[model samples]
Target: MTSERFDAVIVGAGFAGIGAAIQFKRMGIDDFVILDREDDLGGTWYVNHYPGLAVDVPTTTYSYFFEPNPNWSRLFATGDEIKQYCDDVADKYDVRRHIRFGVTVEGARWDDDAKLWRVGLADGTTLSARYLVTATGFLSQPRMPEIPGITEFAGRVIHTTAWDDSYDPGGERIAVIGTGATAVQLIPELAKTAGELTVYQRTPIWVAPKLDVRISERTKRVFARMPWTQRIIRAITDNIYETMINVGVVHYRVPFFRRLNISAMDLCKINQFIQVRDKDLRRRLTPDYDIGCKRPTFSNSYFRTFTKPHVHLQSDGIDHVTADGIVNTDGTKTVIDTLVLATGFDLWEANFPAIEVIGRDGRNLGKWWRENRFQAYQGVSMPSFPNYLSLASPYAFLGLNFFNTMEYQMRLMDRLFGELRHRGATTFEVTEQANTAYLDRMTELLGDSLWTLGNCASSRSYYFNPHGEPSLLRPMSTQDAITEASTFPLSDYSFV
Candidate 1:
């Protein structure tokens, strides 16, 4: 079979891929294809259909900067709404025409002499591209914990990512494992209907009130008529988030931010106390580690869910599973008819394993990262992986909101592609020296960030690599990221 060829091959049809496609189209380069494993375009939104599924961030903050939506029904949009928004974006930009749905990319290898990327598909087909962009998102994969006797359990096992619509928890004893963001949102919804709900918590999380309100149609019209109004709201929202980041995330180790962290912690304490009147339950829910150690949660009813008569919280470690129930480490067995695993995704492993990338001299990207810690120059390009760009790599995940991260990545890519066209360069790759220097500076700056100094090592956070170092979030202000991506010299990469 003749292998298909294109100027670029983008893996994923999420926000990053769509954004990249739009930017490339606007720049008059359309010889590319977007391949997604799903039948539809929305990546995470398409897969996760659990009850109470919604965006953790504000709707305005979570959206694309250029294509602002004035018709968000609520401050925090639901997963279905977000999926619709992504579909609308794909429709508006005519991106659907270039997408190959239900296509699985197994691996890709860089061809040295040809100076092109040979992408492998699951069907044993090959596609050649001058450049490869991996926009496979951070939260795409779901992980289930290794519980003994899991298969022997006759009850239905459900994961948050793979929620069964036909399975009803009403009047059934349900055991939900995990206390992260997904669990926080799901527990409240389950408590309302479940006859007996038991939540097994491995670690407690710092949860703040979700002050979400429905946006009035009149307000939406005002935004649509006068787009500047929406922009102003976005600016104010961004400033508020930045201030919180300064105190809780970016500068938590600094003396000034210590006071802010204390104040924030107090607010969380008050929220929990007010919602959970039972002292025992409240104490079980309160986190021992510092705020921002793990991914923080936001919910209006998560704490209040514990006050329900049927809701139960167990902080004891789980030993194993039996045919009828789960046994706590203390030998207490709780019989339940259904089991739900909210265990989060394996961050680095899932992100890298989704696609096997073989670089120059048969260098496997996964093995390289394991041998030498996960490091990428500017969070986009690697030293050996020439013409292969990654959207959400180490030090590239801006924790404030993912839209900002996508925008910056797409912006940098636009510039790089422009330079390639102007200079007629055959290939481009970050130099080993530049990659090392960039990582060194990032390490120095992260020395004062919360991920490094603020009790995160013991939180069971997915932010850290296997070596126990936080390698996920970029530890700088949003503006700093914008400036660096905008003004950085393109000469850092060797183009030929």
Candidate 2:
């Protein structure tokens, strides 16, 4: 078996891993390696390339605050543009040299005697590092539906994650099996070309109108010349999204904020009413649960796509797939030439840990999270995982924009590692007391959030884990998260 050693090892080459590597470079820590199973970086941007794919959040707020892209073609950048941005950031930071593509990390275990982590690869090789960071994103794993006879379907099957660029569905009968954010983007595109399109939705989504517009070359040139102009735009966009989360979702218990949530719901209803003419179709598309129960999306064409004569909405759940069609729970069958599954990722079952992480005392991270609730100190460190950080851990995500989460995590890394350097420490682990305290505090704070108090039982959101706890989000404002990352007590960690 081959073995290599490094100062640190990152288990993903996505934006998060790239950010960690950048922070390490800033700390003058050069002896680190990044591993990714994919042939390239960009993470989700690299994986998802379905039709009509674009950033749901405004481009001004969706990117790294440190590295601004002035060349976005629109307010909502396309998937290709985001992927290019990832490439540009990695190139600019010179982290590409430290990255090893097409390497699958099977697991990592803490070597107590060695005081290092041993990361096992799929090729029967091992790499040891003083510090380990898992940046396997929250939406890394793709989930295929559990419907019976899916394999028996004789038509072409396509998951949005594994979209075939060459295959054109024009004039082809298509049956889509989701109404999530991905489906919301894809269904509209499919409707324009598909001969007959049937959408099978288990739960309806709350979609607001997309206020998207093209960015003129003049604006780009101005942003390039005066970057502060772009920063101001970013700030405005960020505040808008933050208010949506904090007031309409997190502070749902307050009467005023609850009223704001109602107003937002009304806005979505108005959007639907304006686009969809049929009352029955509008009612079928309307979500019974509150808005924040699921991750809401913004779209102008998704609702209107149903009004097309070629498009059909099927609310009856899937029963099974026949040889050439899908059988519905309502005793109906929809024959189709193509089956498109936008079922999204499996968060609780497959992605909480993403890989086998054996920490101190052989404690399996996945099993522990299942037995106990998914808990992490500041959503980065765990009690037994010394010198390790999980960037996409429970309660790590903040607001709607992922860049906000990455920004705070970058700050947390800076503080944590800065403390390590100050103490001349080789290893550090969060104290069990701190972990429990953080978990309790998060639980208490989430008591007022929409996920906890609002009607989410039928939302079927990935936000709620198997324990029925909405532990995915931090349930706090972006500023608070950033402040805590920088000001958290260093004594909460055991350094040695």
Best by TM-score: 2
Model 1 Cα lDDT, one tens digit per residue, 1-496: 3289998899999998999899889878799999999999888888888899999988988899998999899999999899999999999999999999999999999999998899999989999998898989888888878888888889889999888988888899999999999998889888888989999998999899889999999999999999989999998888888788866778877888977877787888888988988898888898888787778878879999888888888898888899999999999999999999988887877785468999999999888888988888778889889999988688888875899888788778778878887898879999998899998988888888887877665588888888887888788877888878877788898999
In angstroms, how far off is 36's CA in candidate 1? 1.1
The lDDT of each candidate is: 0.87, 0.94
Best-fitting candidate, scored by lDDT: 2
Residue pairs in candidate 2 whose N, alpha carbon or C atoms collide under 3 angstroms:
none
Candidate 2: where are CA atoms >4 Å away? none
* Worst ten in a row by lDDT for model 2: 1-10
Output the TM-score of candidate 1. 0.98
Candidate 1 Cα outliers beyond 4 Å, as residue runs: none
Give the Å shift of residue 422 in candidate 1: 2.1
The digit string of per-residue lDDT tens for model 2 on 165-234 reads 9989889999999999999999999998899999999999999999999999999999999999999999
